[model samples]
Target: MSANTTSFKHVSYLWDEAEAAKLAGDEVALLIYRSNLLGADLRLTNYGGGNTSCKAMAKDPLTGKEVEIMWIKGSGGDIGTLKKSGLAALYVDRLRALRNIYRGIEHEDEMVELFNHCIYDLNSKAPSIDTPLHGFLPFKHIDHLHPDAAIAIAAAKDGEKITQELFGGTIGWVPWQKPGFDLGLQLKECLDKNPGIRGIMLGSHGLFTWGDTAYESYINTLEVIERCADYLEQNYGKKGPVFGGQKVQSLIKADRLSKAAEIAPILRGFCSSERSMVGHFTDDDRVLEFINSNDLDRLAPMGTSCPDHFLRTKISPLVLDLAKDEDLSDVKAVKEKLAPAFDAYRKMYTDYYNTCKHDNSPAIRDANPVIIIYPGVGMFSFSKDKQTARVAAEFYTNAINVMKGAEAVSEYTSLPRQEAFNIEYWLLEEAKLQRMPKPKALSGRVALITGSAGGIGKAIARKFVEEGACVILNDMNAERLAEAAEEFKKDFGKDAYATAELDVTNQPQIEVAMKAAALSFGGVDIIVNNAGLSISKSIEDHSQKDWDLLYDVLVKGQFLVTQAATAVMKKQGMGGDIINIVSKNALVSGPNNAGYGSAKAAQLHLSRLNAAELGADGIRVNVVNPDAVISDSNIWAGGWAEGRAKAYGITVDELPAYYAKRTLLNKIILPADIANACFALTGGLLSKSTGNMINVDGGVAMAFAR
Candidate 1:
């Protein structure tokens, strides 16, 4: 079913009965359909945080007779983007048979292995640990979700009493229990005792609803969440300004972004002790309201109550409380404070681990935080990539909603320390982490390529993305920029890159572009100064306009872009890479090349100067000089190619062959070859080398760096 046009007051309903009818006879397909509809709304569930299931009668391969089968979301799968292959199929009887072994809670990890024997489809995905929660239940369809509204009720101090008052006898309450065989049994007992109940509220957990049919299950889940939201909404504002009223005032929208930009990199650096991380910043109203409130210090430390929220956000966020009179725009002020704060956070986490670790717990993971809360500024979250970082921030937002709702009608309560520790260090969760694929070499880095609409610039952007870095594709041509953006989005993903349309010579435009980059994927870690044009002319023939044009697009443009990017990089307190795409002409003297060659020489020297100036900040500056890369290069366009051929006494079409013949390797250079050198300098092979020039012209004796 597609998204709905109808606006919702409390919780949105997306289930389309007409659409469900199309898959009426196919129970598994119907289950997938229902799961998608429920997952479509964040009011119901967050990404990869919940599961759904359905039981159907299927023909057994051995007996040639119908037997009951269960189809459920598999391990490490998301319901919103789920496909048929993503479901795990199991024989209901085999799953039920595991009860014969009847191991206690001490053997919780062992029950996961027995599920392999219950496979109805030999090639089905491995079953999730939550399988028994649905299999042992008597319902045909079940949904286990962590909706913000439901979690607010489940996480309240008087949650049991609230559940009884809000849901009456229709929904029962289950005390805090780590999900496993024991929890499933408890749920079964609850159902057995409360025969007509629709579902039960899981304390400090989420909501679980069931129905005999897929449609019934979907509606029941929606109705229950909406009822909670309606009740919370009715009582929410009756208690005066939320969160004990605001204690601190927020910065204007513009200053908020600038302050956030100043804060994001330092926080990101703190989190990167184990490995580099990408950052995401949010300055929305909801975050501002929570962080600026009087209860922020109290509520934030209490932590997120939902397991899904806690896992992504960590046990507690690192909170930065600004002095009332201190300036938020001072990078030096913030950095000095963050250094101590980071140290304290790491020590605190390590202490927590040492205090609560099981003998067999996974060795201490990274002690850095995944979320940070800064009052009057904004929130910053970090992870291995932009998407994960963004989701981490979003999950924190969901936590904010829950905290607000719970505080309105009842006191907010987080999971007890022991309970939160048990879930965080759970062996099953450790196994899931181990299963993730290795990250690419350039993973978590963000690159911005100027003149990336086509040719060498576009090729460099593509290479960075292929190596797992997010890129911002910038060019002056709107049409080409759109086309490049479309291709990158299609080939990689929507989050792989963002596009900025601006001329490199424009300082205002350059500033705007860098801001867009910060907003798109946190901050820029790499810059490729590649926007330029070539003018082939002799001393007597060269015009003032020609010299100015070459300098404006090549020399001055690089300076402007670098100047703007440096502010963000230094503020981030994270060292970065700057690659200048100069030319062979920079070091060699050739006929009819005075204008182009001189500008390139200036660019080369400018890069060396930047390398020396920014070295204290750990920012590396380098140059990639390419020659005769004619395949997709715009430099060999207009009259430049023909004029160069005429000067060499060859036809315009022979430019490629002539340039290759002069090279030491006798090879025609391509865009990918230039891309390789850029990657090598920034990808850590020659990471220590800076202010160095690497020629990508195959080989040119005269142009070689000495």
Candidate 2:
């Protein structure tokens, strides 16, 4: 099924008015309620990426004296899912004291500790990263969100103009600033300038609204977003292309298992951690064309839904259209082609940052896109968690809709590149970077890998960390799963990953893993279906059990993982990448491995099918077919190779030579080789390619079944 590209509708959240009213009189509860309502309205703050606060008088537990305290959203709690425990009660005096101290730390290692100390309530979970800002606000109730609608208008050419038009003189507009102290200062200045203003508009960022009551605060936010949405509709006229029930592509069976194994460790990291991740799946060419558009020169830098969204969806989408148009329809080949464009885009981004630094010193986000949208296809957003993805998707779709509208007029003109850079590298934006250290490549991004505890799956997880991705490592072996996690840390560093002990073949486990990954990483962006089990017996000797085992891990597991990941990706709206590790066996028939070969063949076709169906969502699903390269360490351990060599009437030494001579490269293929292919498929370089399969095996085309 195609993703939901339909325009948004106003539907009330599962908000309990009576419950909210119950918190009205109590200052602390009122603040929590306001935050809850605010988050419910804007997908951006859903699980609580944002925070809320109220400064009120409360008796100190230590002393009889009453003092002002701020009740703020607790750390790591989704504002939409908040409870009393989700709030931190920090002393206003202490908070104010910290405000007076200049933030001395700049680098992340120094900042995370300082941020940790900034918390006011130890009993409460970690405080919101915006605690300092919350402390600065004078209002009794403050609500902040990476609102989808507001961001849509804010990240555009005339965002300020639109804000001015929508709220008239009542709203305060601040250019993007980093969130903590810098944003707090900016917010304070705005509040100081307009004491009666109901809300604040962050340029290329989010929306902050305050009121005397929770309902009032929520209503104001609702009014603002609605106004912006209405303005967009009137200006742009909403309607996207309708897919006429075209059959979308999916991954093949054998490729699926191999990919599952490869992506498992990363998936485990995300699922086991509190963070969540989501991924998109598709390999449609038209969709890729949209993503890799050179038109970015005329448009603004597309980002996650808002500033906070960066934590979920990184900074840019990996354009994937090149796969469809390339001569070799393979993940690796297309990635090579896309490198120049991606580098160009990065260089351009750096130039823009330089221009916008206005100050001699400036902070810049890494040259990675959090949301990836393939034109004429779809888009995907990655986050450490699901809430982040949901918010990103909402804003991204709306922004794209508006951009489409602008295109209809003349050409879509977003904020100037420099202006986008200003927001992207704002101090408030910078403050968020201070709180948590980024993992390797896919750090904030989510990954799902099957059979991650062993062999190639484990290797892929390690590689992703080196590049900065939070992974959900999955495997059926509980003992191996623990061992892999330890091995990853030992190889990479302390706290290098997360893991889940799951049988990828079971749809239930796959679904659970998907949700868990989202919660762990905030959202998923990459899926590597790299789990597989081989049967050595020939076709006549192959039992149904063997067929089922091979098919379950190789084909069905991929489908289940992709299916779940795609749901989260579509909601996130930034698009996603799915990589399938298939075998050259799909291309060449082999003895004693017919069941495995048949499964691999089906998997190859399936990858293409997924690409077609999910293309509209900007998902890129690709396959990597590797020739025989002895992946199963267990096989070597069990003397299976020696036994097979005897059966083939060849010495064991000759077997290795036999496989090597068959390939053009004449090189030994390692797990790292396949890992490289998977990397190219999901990273920003191959942003435009999808549904293509590249052969990694030595020149053996003996199984050319496609």
Candidate 3:
């Protein structure tokens, strides 16, 4: 069957003979290998969307004999990255015994507790809820996947008929049943009735296939999906037009992306009424096709048929309807529709909970759509983090594929409302949600910081990321930015940090940096204006170039960054924070520091004016004054320490002690101390305080704000 699956139009086979040969004897490794292959392609399964299992013989510690055990992908684990530790190991004989004691489908959920008693390994992860399906089936190896192509057929009105038509008698069909002991029994019955079948199409669910070996089962799943996809493609092509043809023309690429960015923050604000949401935008051709199509109105509200798709995306997506000739660039027009659209969606979701929720159901979660389908642009997906938001978009695209395939061939069918509600608010699912760690201080926030390649700037960037903020680290040095980004990726993750080559003094570069923040993680919620240089010189020695360099990076840089970032803030209607990394020199008199001190004073005054101006927009401006953050400071690295020491009538080696003794507390300051003050201002601690300054200088009384 794998040999015949040489060239697949809709999906990749991805089975490697050399790779399989390495894990020939380790049944569990082969299972993981096969599962990864099936999960590698989105055409096969969405992220964390499917289960695979292998029934093998292992030596039993208690019995001192070989016993049949099942190794299956664990609950909440993705098959594509399935590790041995991620696999739940259970006694196959014990798992099968639970069927005998099952009261009926009405009390099938009780079986989950019974599964714990059958555990063969103490350290294995919790078994998936589909354990019954794998254990009840009389196969050595099994694959249950929510491949879009297979689901399209499973969700068709004539799904059962389509299964037989495509696979002849090689694959049987089971009626619609949610995953539980009862559905397991139904699958068992269908297989018992059909002699020598390759797999079964579980109605409004997914495809299940089995074989004697892991490779054979993997190949069978692929062959079944390929054939179903091929059949659907033929019928889809013969039927003409996706989603009943386009009703509106799509906006051009630049206009579309610009529009998506323009509306993204507004949508994010609306979705974040209960809690903040990071957003991801996609203008893929298929998404545009669906949104611009005539049938979009009819199909989007019907929701997704697959449980996996519905889980991440919510029960249904909110569609933003627009007229055929609506002006895509008129953001004001789109903005006006958004409030009513979101209000209606919230009301609908609330009604769904009221109608479907039981007394024991977990309290209603945030009643906002995870996915928003917009006309003229594309889709916007929102979640607690960038990665989750991206994954939500990916899952919705899978649903789009399913809808396209189903509608083209046969009628696309959504899951029954009650079933979807049941699955969404299921007690087991609620437990999983409850188990997740509490959100961090800056979760769902995006921060843009300049001069973040080193010193206090990079320190602040790292702290924001640690507190759950996605960051755009900006620097004039591209190499330094790349180096910092790699450190961030290594320490935290790639999704947590992005880099933009920016000279804060360059207005155009600052604008580009702001756009990078928007395009990477929705929009900016915080800005740290920390980029600067020291050009210390006496009145006689000061040059025009020295003054411009000091003022350009220190004073002008802050202004440009604030201007660009605040523009985005006002559009979001969510407000934001701007922190200026000022200096003790801003207030204290110093020698050989005329250019640097005046620029610092300018930065300080600009921050105060901004605080007063942007307060109406709910934007806060604050300042952090550090006396001598010499360690890891870019200013010090660029010969500022030597200049300051020479001016103080001391050597560079004694500069730290000299600055420390001048402070009331007699302590040298560090970058991390400055970073902490920044976090306190923006991390919700000083939420009500703005236009204020925090001294992280070990008590510089002379520089204290009066």
* Best-to-worst TM-score order: 3, 1, 2
Number of clashing residue pairs, candidate 2: 153
**Tens-digit lDDT track of model 1 for 538-598:** 8999999999999999999999999988887887767899999999999999999999999
lDDT score of residue 579 within candidate 1: 99
lDDT of each: 0.88, 0.62, 0.87
Q: Which of candidates 2 and 3 reaches a greater lDDT?
A: 3
When 2 and 3 are scored with TM-score, the better candidate is: 3
Model 3 spans > 4 angstroms off: 1-6, 322-335, 657-668
lDDT of 3 by residue, 411-441 (tens): 9999988899999999989888888899999
Sequence-dependent TM-score of model 3: 0.95
Alpha carbon deviation, residue 579, candidate 1 (Å)? 1.5
Could you tell which candidate, 1 or 3, scores higher by TM-score? 3
Task: Score every model by TM-score.
Answer: 0.95, 0.50, 0.95
| Candidate with best TM-score | 3
**Backbone clashes, candidate 3:** 0
Residue 132 of model 1, lDDT score: 89
TM value for model 2? 0.50
